[model samples]
Target: MKDGKRFPVVEENYRFECTLCGNCCTGDQRVWLNPADLMRMALFLGYGHTSELFRQNVVLLDEGENGAWRPRILFKSYKKLRFCPFLENHLDDRGRITGLCRLHPKYKPLICRLAPLGRVWDAETGSEQWLFVKPAPDCPGVNSSRLNSLRETLQQYGSEIEEETAFLKKLQHFLEMKSEPEAYQELFYFIVKRKGEGDKR
Candidate 1:
């Protein structure tokens, strides 16, 4: 459960496919980057270290336990609107301007890859609860008639989702063991290595 409510997994009654309207890429939504996200994005961008990516494009928020660093993608302002830095616009076949993700095909942040789906971690149970978060009032993706089963859609990125979740669990464990904010902060800000957390994959 998140925000005091349990989100049910997507059901057969629901249908969704991104229309590329770019609505989900904008507004006040936050594109949180987990450790895996930081690592992959840095590698994709040819950065030598996750800290370098943080220095250039990502912002570490002081929103985690004991103010442990939480990484988030930086937004770019265009035409008085704020959007993900990776958001790009192009003319569709009908000449309408539509949005595209620059990191797509590979390297999109897990949150962006989830699209119409969402998941919440229940630490007490150490399990994930999946749910629908799209067909958002402003998004037309849910109206698409050509849609895949929720199971299939999710399976397409199952491995990646699991890997990120594992890393998150590790992070939570670290926070619980470390009492000093600075101790955890360096793990994200300056260190390119994962300490004793295993390979940097």
Candidate 2:
């Protein structure tokens, strides 16, 4: 049952928990970094600015409307399997993954804090919404205190959540309009024109 305070508790029984399995941090998961995340990562790495770090490590995935570009950092891999560049699989003398991140805790991205949670937009209203997902089937924290922790983390980054929601809405709108090229071109022009007007202010 949802605490019924922060997020709308859906039919699915939700809980908070992380087993430190590191499964969520690895693989082809779309790890999109935002401006705030870039700043945090740079500060953590003792770099004066994120520009240098971004220029060297990030690759542009796609171009969005108004010249916005989506970039992702490449991960280092030993063999065919790719891991999160910030993840360290080694254990201490006690043999624990320890949930330690190579990037400073402050620098971790919005997605990092909101793991097991996803954002979507309602087609009818064009409003954004959030949904929680189980990190893994084997995760013991599926319906426990871990859920609460995740919610708290999300609350702390409320602004980022809203921004993400807006981005999702725009992306969805773009995709839906793509099927109608003429309509899409018109809409794109309208948005660009409005953005240009806003920049003048």
Candidate 3:
């Protein structure tokens, strides 16, 4: 095979113009939700600024320590497939995939908001690598000639860089708390409650 390794996530840059075909939102992929995402989505869905309702009904917390990161809060993939529950399929006369993600910019999760672009985090160095990937094999966004700045494009998406940084700081503090096993569950609830408190105000 030819050496088509492409570039590192950080150096990756490509043109993309999302057609909102919903292909990316449909599949067995992980949609990780951070505190910010939870809070924003709750508020968007009129959950009264607190994620309690949303958490109870919409999200799942992955506490397994088997991966690079520990204690992840994520959206419940629709049914058994990776289809996002929030994805709304638009159809034409005969009914076919036309558009998706009904809650696009406003209530979209952080991951969904950053679709077609990929990111990798370095825990040790506290750095992130960026990659511009095709949202799907048939995604027309990747083939467009229009070019966009990664930084600028992120800004256009209403990037949560600042909030993500703050969340990491909170995560650090939570890690430092290092609760005993008996209290770990409580700690999770506490974090959730605390994270949503700000939006309550």
Candidate 4:
């Protein structure tokens, strides 16, 4: 009795309880920050407005086709690779990651909230889909007996999930229409370069 048009039967067996292992936080994947996230994070950090905090802590990704700026967390690296500045690999005396995000519980990115659920879009039909990311074979959370019902899981984080789905759909559509990776790269570079040039003058 499920609606096939909007709700396809997706596998919902996997359940997760975050051990705060921080594996996913240490990558170069795009970390999108929406307005709501920014506001909440700023408030949690006692900032009157998030604009300055966002600008200081985040970098703008390439502008979308609609010319809106997309923001992502920025990091400095010894090499050319990017990472999250808030991620730490070592534990402190108290056994917590030192110099890492103290506000992780409140300021995690929307994508971080939807971890283990990779969103993809079908280019031909423009439909969104979700797939589970099986944890590393050694992860302890994988063996937990607690399970979250599909409705409960969806309700807990639906807005962010929907936003991610929409973003993936748009990205997939663009990729399907684009001729080559270089073409998309050039487009992104052109947009970013133009903005930089404008700032210099």
Candidate 5:
């Protein structure tokens, strides 16, 4: 999708409360992670280092040549349903809906925290625009009135958004370089590389 694509915001505000339906967390999409996400999850899980999650299958390693590697939250499945490894059926138990994110509140990936709302960073404009991607197959939470607290929800993750935006800015700069061999490892680590946990959902 193009950046700044217009989306219908309800009553002049975005309306979306993740019902923990797990639809956003599932499907063929992978939950890409950044160093900030890894550090949060690691600390939350009581791991001294981020690498520890790699060994436990909590996070998957995408090692580019050398020691250059990035971490991703590998997808896991229950029966035939696929989702982020950290998503669990907790908060609610209705229909196909599950509970909540295991790493929520703080360690949740930025992507998950900003569900329903999509964002694209425009380097040319030097700004990031929030958007609403086409809704998932049929997610009820997207239009739920409970999604009224856009500012408050975002406020809770102010530091995280800053960290994410800063990380993206750096990555964008490195990607623009003719060749990033000198900073190849660091650049690769900063980029959110995708690694499929499986072929099926």
Candidate 6:
């Protein structure tokens, strides 16, 4: 429970399997990225700097909540289409236009790796709970015969998820201590310097 309210928590036996229909890649869904994500993407693309990543593929989203506004980093969709920039569409054997992500299976953002499931953690209590990210009505990956445990899903990222989670907790704490503008600048430089120091793992 958070703020004296209970949230629906997903169980361990939650089952899901991606059919790779590409529905998730076609929407205006925002895939927020952490510093770790930036590092991975930079390493994958062989870029020494992240400025081009922002200029080409990512954007600073002006997110607001409860009269508070902050700049969060997330991927940008194509200018003409409301789909991921990396998303490719091609006709399958069945004559269906299937969506394929160039960065899938590896180099994907953490949220993309944990699609259909989202986590909420309390900074004070250090407790985390998983919730179902509402999928599209016709999404075929919701409940399939192939079962996947929540632990297994998270384990797909191995130790990276743990590191990302820890970093997020610390970042959240830092944000609360500083003003929005200060926090944004600090966060940007921290990510650049932290990743620039050969922290790619």
Each candidate structure's TM-score, on Cα atoms with residue i matched to residue i, is 0.79, 0.61, 0.67, 0.54, 0.69, 0.77
Candidate 4 lands at a TM-score of: 0.54
Worst 10 residues of 4 by lDDT: 186-195
lDDT of 2 by residue, 24-78 (tens): 6566555766545655665566655455554566422444443334445566667
* lDDT by residue (tens digit), candidate 3, 12-47: 355767776777766645666666676666665666
lDDT of 6 by residue, 6-80 (tens): 434677756678877877876666667666676667666776655556555454535443222333445444566
Residues 1-201, candidate 1, lDDT per residue (tens digit)? 344564446555356778888888887677777776776677677765777875685555556533435778877777888888778899999999898988885777888777667776776698766677872458888777866676776688888877877767766776677655455555565334433655554
Off by over 4 Å in 4: 1-10, 63-69, 78-82, 88-101, 121-127, 134-146, 159-201
Residue 12 lDDT in candidate 6: 79
* RMSD, one per candidate, in order: 4.8, 8.5, 5.3, 9.2, 9.0, 4.4
Q: State which candidate has the highest TM-score.
A: 1
Task: Find the candidate with the highest lDDT and give its number.
Answer: 1
Q: How do the residues 98-134 of candidate 4 rate in per-residue lDDT, one tens digit apiece?
A: 3345446666666666655545455567675565553
Per candidate, the number of residue pairs that clash is 0, 5, 1, 0, 4, 0
Question: What are the runs in model 2 whose C-alpha is more than 4 Å off?
Answer: 1-13, 58-69, 92-94, 122-126, 136-140, 143-154, 163-201
Alpha carbon lDDT at 2, candidate 5 = 38
Which of candidates 1 and 6 reaches a greater TM-score?
Answer: 1
* Tens-digit lDDT track of model 5 for 81-132: 7777776765343445475777877667787677766666666786766676
Better by TM-score, candidate 5 or 4: 5
lDDT score, candidate 5, position 135? 40
Q: How far is candidate 5 from the true structure (C-alpha RMSD, Å)?
A: 9.0
TM-score of 2: 0.61
Candidate 1, lDDT over the whole model: 0.70
